[model samples]
Target chain A: MQVYVDGIGILGPGFAGWPASRAVLAGEAPWPGGETEEPSAAILPPNERRRSSALVRWAMHVAEEAIRHADHDPRALATVFASSGGETGVLDQICRSLASPERVLSPTLFHHSVHNAAAGYWGIATGAQHSSTSLSCYDSSFGSGLLEAAAYAEVEQAPVLLVAYDLPPPPSLFPARPLTAGFAVALVLCDRPSRRNLARLKFHLEDVLRDAPDTLADPGIEALRGGNPAARALPLLTAIARRRSSGVRLDYFEEQCLSIEVSPCPP
Target chain B: MVAMTGKIMAPLWISHYTVVTALGRGLDSTFAALRARRSGLRPCDFEDAGLNTYIGRVEGLEDLPITGAELMPFDCRNNRLALLGLRQDGFEEAARAAARRYGAGRIAVILGTSTSGINETEHAYRDRDQDSGVLPAAFLTRYRYTHNTFSLAHFVRSYLGLRGPAAVISTACSSSAKVFASAARFLASGLCDAAIVGGVDSLCLTTLYGFSALDLSSAGPCCPWDEARDGLSLGEAAGFALLERIARTTDSGAVALYGYGESCDGYHMSHPHPEGLGAILAMRGALARAGIKPEAIDYINLHGTATPTNDRVEDLAVNSVFGTATPCSSTKGWTGHTLGAAGITEAVIALLCLTHGFLPETLNTTRPDPALAIRVLIENQERPLGRVLSNIFGFGGNNCSLIFGGL
Candidate 1:
């Protein structure tokens, strides 16, 4: 199946926004080093702003950037939010509270720990009553969510926003699945081509053993992709930024991968 | 809400489905219990962390052994229930047959769960080392496949030895119901020929206490749509369904998935839209995709958590869409609120209604809310039905409605 990517949003260590990251992906600018500043999600109301967690802010940050870049009304597009381990910080807090003698938990923390917490915030932020789905597949979350969003856009013939984000678990659970830093990537996919299209992606499901994802030339970017599942889109993002057609294979499961051939479209 | 008015897609077949809830292990017991209107809920008796609420805890999970050597690492309550669910009614055999018919690489596994292996983590937290303050080595070793949300899919894929695209949707309560929509997309995209979709959520302290913290747990058996309804009774369940393209299936009595619609409330994180605006949109979307009218629906499996707000909002939505004529009931009273697994558990019930030809009564709901305009069935009515709609809504305003009918 073929889908058009009209816009992209990315956030990770050393990369604050899509424009800066696009420059880095294009090798036109030095890779920003060190921790990136997290967004406050000031767009949300004061009540929600106080409740918005790091993961929710990261999700909304990219989603807003992508929708803004695509110039698509957020309300008109369906959404798919994918994360490997959702809000492990909140999970750890709750687990600690549960194990503690108090056995009491903050209601806000309890609700935020849900897998769809970020998606909920997104709906409130944009008032997008369109279909929204939150899913996860461990390390293969990005590939699974992309396929879901792409297929939905194709079937419904409407624009769909695909947001994939993941933050490292707290120190307690970090050893189980460690990550270098937080990562998020968003793609505004449409069934039909538009003037704002960045590139056209043609996807096919291949029945083959999972292959290691392509590494970025920059060690900083490569480390991010290697550690976080959502950053797995870096290779494709690089290709799109370079305005070059490339084939990228994303891990799906044990013996299956989603192969996508990207063709850059003229601005 | 406007009707979908879009091109109707070909229907998908529900070739096989099974459920393991507080009721029983397989369809026979589950159906029998539902027919008897028996409540699976009992006073809370899970692990410590005291809370006075009824719970529908599945029996014998601790004793349920993971038989496969390869699946040992993924062994946990959730996966055990998933394995037990797969073993029931020869679901594994049917899945194997599907893999053979459509190559193992062509069948997808899409399951839903709110917290896959958090129970293992919770237990691990309790067993942390005294001085080190680190989780036990055994826990770390088991964490890879056991604690991950995708572990359910991973375990199922490995157990069946299938290599198809697999994913786990985790939108809290509506997780499993949305998997049907995901499976349909895979089929439509030609990504997979047959898909194994369902949900498995085991009881854990996190959910129990979390719901208690939210004050959404009911002290008594949940009575959805009841005038005295208070809150939901938490439950643990594992439900699976095999979906195949209608053109490829020749199985008799296979229930057809006519349409599915998903939407977000854009209203609130925990609370549903007061008037169920999202619910109406989803129901309308499903009917539009199915190319059917609201009056055509025979019954609705309401997402009645029995919470005052939930039942009231859902009633408003159903009344606005299907009006007061169509019968609707909340099976949650029978199985308790299964969270992520509620979607498939209830979907299975809707399908069973097609086979058994009886509209299940809203168990435990003695006095229906008089203010509600929709028909809330209190008695199991014998009625031959053709089409049914199952609604599953979750936190984050995630709402999904599925239409199932006789082929």
Candidate 2:
């Protein structure tokens, strides 16, 4: 499927926003490895911000940034939020409570445990009534979500926002799925090019047996990409940052990977 | 309110479908239960859950572990239920045949679930060492296979030997229902020719205790639209449907997906919009997409979760869109609310209603709340049905409505 990217939002350990991340991804800046910055979640009402989890905050932050960058009406466009392990920290807490003697779970935590919590919060904060879907594909969640978003844009001939995020699980559950850092990336994609278009992407699924996915050349970014599933978008993001045409393959399924042709559309 | 363009979409043929609920293992048993007006709900006796609420638990899962070395890693109540559902009514053979006809890479597997195999993790957490808080070594397999949301699609795709595009939609109760819309778009975009769309959600402690924490668990069989309706009776179910592009001049008796609409309440997380504004949008959007008026719909399968607030809001929504004239009923009384699987389970029920000419009434709901306005059927209606709409609203205010009609 083909779609034009209008805006980008990214956050990671060393990166903060699209502008800074673009420099790092383009090899023009040093990778300042550190803790991920806490999100303000300014777009959310105060009460919701207080009640929101880290994952929701991270997702909402990027979504807000991308929508602002694209200058699109948040209430008008559809959204797709993808995460490999959604609210793993909250799940861990719930499981621990269930394992305890009292087994008393808080209502807030219980409501926030659903996989679509971020999408829900995004809806509540932005009042976006358009169709929103939350999905997961283990390590390939980003690729899966991108394809879905692109498909929706192409079929509906409308703009769609794709947000992919993942955070490491709590210590007890971390060993099973060892994610190192929190990462999120959001892209506003439309079927047709606009003045805000940053790149055009043509992505399709391919048999993994034919070739392996592309890898990052920088060691630090490569390590980050290997550590977190959402960071798998680094290669494509790099292509966009360089303002050049390139192709990158992303891990999608056990037998299939996504091959994407990225052509920058700089204004 | 979002603008409605009312552009009709091409329908997709539901070539094959099957479901496994507490009603029984196959469509025959399910249809029989509906015909006999019998419910599958029983007293909550699942494992060590001490909650004093009714449940619609699928029996025999304890002895139905997923077999074979390739699938042994996915041995959990959820996947076992999925396998059970796939084995019913020749769905596996039909899916495999479609895979061959379209090529394995040309068919996609899209399924839905709220908590996929969290039951395994709950057990693992219970078995963890107290000192180090370390889970058992065996949990690695469970986490990678059973606990993962994508595990459902992975298991189904691998079991059927299909290597096409696959993903697990986890939008809570609206999960499975949205799979239809996604599958249709994927097919339209030339990503796949045919698709396997379904959902599987098994009973787990998280949902049980979680709902209980919110005081949304009914102590008796769920009674939708009842004046005294209190809370919902949770159930586990798995349902699958094979969707192929409709061919020219299809059989008149065939059931096809005519339209699907998805929207978010953007109001609350657990509670629905007070006036069911989101529900109304979804229903209207669906009707617009199907290119049919409200009167064209003969039967309405309500998402009456039996929760007082939910039923009341849905009542308002239905009345506003289709008015009080359309015959509407909630099937939760028969199979309890299956959460993520509710969409597909109710969808399969709607397809059955289209094929069997049976419009099931709202079971266990005797006294309809007079405050509500929609026509709530408390007794079975046996009439030839053409088009049916099924509603599924979930946490995050996620709402989806699907239209199934005889082509």
Candidate 1 stretches with Cα past 4 Å from truth are A206-212, A254-256, B1-5
Q: What TM-score, over all chains together, does every model reach?
A: 0.97, 0.98
**Could you tally the backbone clashes for each prediction?**
0, 0
lDDT of 1 by residue, A192-223 (tens): 98798999988765543355556577887787
Error of model 2, residue B166, in angstroms: 0.9
lDDT tens per residue, model 1, B1-407: 42342558789988998999999999999999988888899999997758889999999998987866777899899999999999999899999999999998889899999999899898888788867779888888788789788889989998998888888899989999999989998898888999999999989999899998899988899999899999999999999999999886466677889999888899898999998999998998899889999989999999999999999999999999888999999998888999999999999999989988989999999999897778989999987898999999889899999999999
lDDT of 1 at B192: 91
Shift of residue A258 alpha carbon in model 1, Å: 2.2
TM-score for chain B in model 2: 0.99
TM-score for candidate 1, please give it: 0.97
As for model 1, its CA RMSD to the true structure in angstroms is 1.6
